[model samples]
Target: MARQTSDCPFCAIAGGADAHRVWEDEQVVAFLDTRPLFPGHTLVVPREHVPTLTELPADRLGGFLAAVQRLAGAMEHGFGAAGSLVAVNNRVSQSVPHLHAHVVPRNPKDGLRGFFWPRTRYRDEEHAAETARTLRRALGGSS
Candidate 1:
């Protein structure tokens, strides 16, 4: 088991601190976000204290992601949402250092701008291809 941090709120929740918990198992805990983007928005986190997704052990990834998938479906079926959005903030825009996947219920024209950020096209085809090539190389794949 990973050592729990005294200051991490997610760790406190995992340690049975007060929270509007929705789901739990040996591996994860799902609960409502205090400030939700939507009514049914939930945050899912591993029971163990992992600061970020990259720091989460490979063996634990499957269980954490499985719980996230389940919650996404729940957001649609239980919350009567047209669909759901699942997202993870590795470091940037991550309010808590503890890794958590946000499962948000979604409907058409809910007034939330797409991606919550301005969208822009690549400079051109060559620019796009170059970006892809760089990512592929980083992944140790042929570009």
Candidate 2:
């Protein structure tokens, strides 16, 4: 397992600090992003503190991606979104040192015009939890 750093926010969230977690398993966790591109923007990350995709152990890679895939599907079903924008930043633009895949819900001409990320915030915790609940239901359970 990769060592957790005291300063990594993602690591803290993985360790069960106050985060709007939507899904979790022995190997991974999915949570709502604080500054979301949309209502259901989520981030999937390894429970272990791996810094980049290249560093993810081969055995864990499949499971991590599976979780990401599940989140993508949930985004579509839960939000009634046309699709999702999935991405990963290895190191460059990686706000958190721990590796994470972004799953942003998308729709036709939602005003995301280009590569520029115009972030938005949830109305409140209730708003975030409602979004999480929808995603959890789409995933078949709330964990």
Candidate 3:
């Protein structure tokens, strides 16, 4: 087990100083959002105190994502959400020093907007899909 050295909420939770427990494993822990952006939104945090993905040991990354995948399936069925977004804010926008993923459930008419950007245009969906597939395969399995 690692010890906390910061006041980050994730660090506190990992250190057993908070009380919003929901999921936990050797390398990762997930808990319901206290200030949820949507219903059933949860945060999946790495147990180790690494600040970001680039700082994490390769071995720990799998456990972190495995936890997120578990929550993704459960969120869709449990909350009736159409899709889910596993978002992470790094660098300039990072609120907490510790890296965490926001597993947000998205449903049609959920009053949420798409993650698309204003300056973006869909020139080709097929190419995009193919590229995504290649990336998924490279990342282990098709996600």
Clashes of each: 0, 0, 0
Question: What is the Cα-based lDDT of residue 121 in candidate 1?
Answer: 50
Q: Mind sharing the TM-score for model 3?
A: 0.74
By TM-score, highest first, what's the ranking?
Answer: 2, 1, 3
| Cα lDDT, model 3, residue 17 | 69
TM-score of 2: 0.95
lDDT of each: 0.77, 0.90, 0.67
lDDT of 2 by residue, 1-143 (tens): 44678898888888889888888888998999999999999999998999999999999999999999999988888889999999999999999889999999999999897879899999988999888888888999853
lDDT of 1 by residue, 40-124 (tens): 5679999888889999999999999998888787667665689988999999999999999988778998877866733245555
Top model number, lDDT: 2
The alpha-carbon deviation from the true structure for residue 64 of candidate 1, after best TM-score superposition, in angstroms, is 0.2
CA lDDT for candidate 1: 0.77
Candidate 3: what lDDT?
0.67
Error of 1 at 119 (Å): 20
Candidate 2's C-alpha runs over 4 A off are none
